[model samples]
Target chain A: MSATAVLRVDNLESYYGPIQAIRGVSLEVREGQLVTVLGANGAGKTTLLKTISGVMDPEKGTVKLEGTEIQGNEPDRIVARGMVHVPEGREIFPLLTVAENIAMGAYTRSDKAAINADEEMVYSYFPILKERMTQAAGTLSGGQQQMLAIGRGLMAKPHIMLLDEPSLGLSPLLTEEIFDIIRRLNTEQHVTMMLVEQNAAVALDVATYGYVMELGRIVMADEAATLAASKDVQEFYLGISQDENQRGQRRWKQRKTWR
Target chain B: MDFVQLIVSGLANGCVYGLIALGFVLIYKATEAVNFAQGDFMMIGAFVCLGLTNADFMGLNFWLAVPLAMVIMAALGYLFDWGVLRHMFGQSQVSIVILTIALGFILRFAAGTIWSHEPVSLETPFAGQDLRFGGVVLGIDEIAIIVVTVVLTGSLFVFFSKTKLGVAMQAASQNQLAAYYMGIPVKRIQSLVWALSGAVAAVAGILFASKGAIDPSSGLLGIKAFAAAAIGGFGSLPGALVGGLIIGLVEPLSARFAPDGFAGIARIAPYAILLIVLIFRPGGIFSQTQKKKV
Candidate 1:
């Protein structure tokens, strides 16, 4: 990890009306690192990403991108500052053509030559998109739409990306393919990422660091390999218990530790 | 020849309605609110042009007056959204509809107060002139209306497809939240859409005034245009024009040719078409049914 963090969230708090969705969450992603937040449904994973990207304003806390405080800024402004969010469910512009969808990702940019080059680069990552450039995005199959979503995010030339469940609704083969592209984007392009996922096992494989959250709180944090090897994580998250006879007892013990 | 003339005149009138309907579609696509004040916006445009060109007021040339009116109307549209409509964002669809209806009444009342409820004609160089195509006769004003509609609609089509800002506006219209995440200023785009709609309404106003007299009630024609929009597919631009033409043709045709008591049906011709369209194809002719995925 780099000495300086590219992105950081400090004492963050967010809510959906009266219900607090994220509670005093703090985390950092150093430059060129792939960090993953592994949590179950209702674990505030999506809320944290939404707050950082300015989709939903945090009630309390600060988000810093390269040391600039950007909390409560408009989502577009946050995107302009080199951070983009590929939201859960892959919110691709259904009515727009695949090419037009990618063009919109560069809405804040004006350099025509660079934008064209970036677009071609996106095509290289997903050649299928090049074939379907004129087709409406809504017509795409689920995996293809996911690729288009990520491609749209890359069109912004983001320094750090916040990906929320990229593997959602994908077959196992497609999920592995998507994760491979994510890994390549991190390693080859040197793009920093903060990924939120329910697929903890696959996420841990690509992530350099990981955090485990439950019900709006981080229960454990460690290096990805260390966390993956932890007995608590193996039993509960990875769904692997070595002692089958005491599996129920171990599950109870893990719950007690997390609480 | 009389029938042909009626067809020509109806088409010109339909072009005017189509222009107003286009404005409604533009605003609705961006914000999803069917602005009831659209017709009143047209009324304001006509009144503004009249005020500028009348000898008693600014007395500007027809050329200068029309553009000035459009600019003022555009500003008014921006203010309407920035000051009033923006606050209504995320409200229930019913409340927003009611709010726009209330806004329509306010605009009509304001226009009546300012213009004194008197009907006035807009003077243009082409007024009272006619062109003869063998047995078929077309008014110079009618020709101007057709030409302007074609040019404006064509430019708009190109603009949306070819320009960056235009594409951004379309993207914002399609999915505001997704566009926002891509660094497009969605709120600003909404304001811009309103302004553009206002400018188009101004054109419709000027064109209508060129044909005949205009008063505060002239904005009521916007209701016909709204019907036109509904007939075309509320969000489709080309659909607005086709729907307007259909309404335009049906009205005069029914009035002139209908037997006995059926003559009154001309007044409700546009609404009649709307009902038929709603019954047959609720999405309108041009609208694609959207399917939400889980």
Candidate 2:
């Protein structure tokens, strides 16, 4: 584990009713860094987040947050410890009002004034949520619901945000906006993020560090820039041919979109 | 004038059933469990009031004993949750319904054991008194039932709408797992809901006993209340009241006009309404508020 590691996982093994979803996987998320785990479908990305958030218990191995073991705690206790999971499907309470959904996220907080302030911060980040605050959450469009899911997680004031496929089912423009929001949250708000994404291109574009997960194991871990330029990554994940890689580098230089 | 008086009396009687139906709605909303033992719980509530207010026992004043009876009924509800309902978790809905049916038998037997299966009348301070208005006669006891139901319903509305705990209960009713994630202490809320429902049943039971003669078998009135709940929409609060009113009106009106075989048909008005409503709109009239996502 690195000296600045905020979360440390040692040989974490998780299962779904005797079917092993994750087997002996080890990873570390460092403080103030945006880390992305890129994996194909059924590669245990969702299971890992569920295990870390205490929704599912790992059969073995230690999971420590800030050097303290927090394995086997319930999801609510894990959430109270400031590790909030924005689940894969944007499971916002459909019948609840948008404002009610946001308020519910602050259920564990003791300080009403602090919760109120956080509520302000969340609505400011997603101004559209404020406009339809009292509307039923199910009525929101797919992109808006995703934004609400992320915003609801933000209402918890998490120390480390674990987002599972945050851009799933979103349009190209909305996907870019979601990633840009992630970038701003990482840099401006200084929130440590661990994003699980199948979109390798966009994940590497915004992430400070990247890990390639195949069959529940980390096959590659490197700085984002190095991984993006690697020939193996270009062919297998990034879909950039050797000639196109050169063109992509030139095109990258002409834009500062992520910054 | 006579017709107006009869309607007023029927409305008052309907309020009693409505109160019990409200209990059915409360538990159904929170747990999605239809408690077949609701009428038996009401019976227990009346028995508790009889025991507490009896001159031979606590010798407590009748008015003073009412709240205590409600408290005892609520405690029984909490115990019932802790003892039976909690154990039935993860069981099929049919199994739960059957378990409640079994509980009804147990409650009836227990009440009979304690009170000897005989009739007992709760003598109120203002028993057998009628207020006459324009040659129309209205029993004070009946008027009292209406007043109490209005007050209780009003307070319950405020509780569900304004309080934080109430909002948490409503959230839990919609999604138990989601409520747990919000740190709402879902188990405790479930228990509280049971207690509240039980207390409401007890109120209805006491009101019922004041209006008529009672025996252990009087718990059968729960059938009428259950019908009222179904008529109003199984999970709706105000629907129960309206169902109860419709049921109440149908009975005497039929008894007065037809005065024969039609009495049975009139008594079943709430059930008929329930069937018609379920056929057209399964969620009830207020179903627009909640819709399941595919």
User: Per-candidate TM vs. native?
Assistant: 0.97, 0.89
Candidate 2 residue pairs in clash (backbone atoms < 3 Å): B232-B239
CAPRI category for model 1: medium
Per-residue lDDT of model 1, residues A227-253, tens digit only: 999987887789887564544454344
lDDT for model 2 comes to 0.83
Over B72-114, each residue of candidate 2 has an lDDT whose tens digit, in order, gives 9999999989888888788998998898889889989998898
Q: Which portions of model 1 show Cα errors greater than 4 Å?
A: A246-256
User: What's the count of clashing pairs in each model shown?
Assistant: 0, 1
What candidate 2 gets wrong by more than 4 Å, as runs, is A1-4, A230-259, B259-261, B288-294
State how far residue B18 of model 2 sits from its true place (Å). 2.5
Please give the lDDT score for candidate 1.
Answer: 0.90
Distance from true position, residue B37, model 2, in Å? 1.9
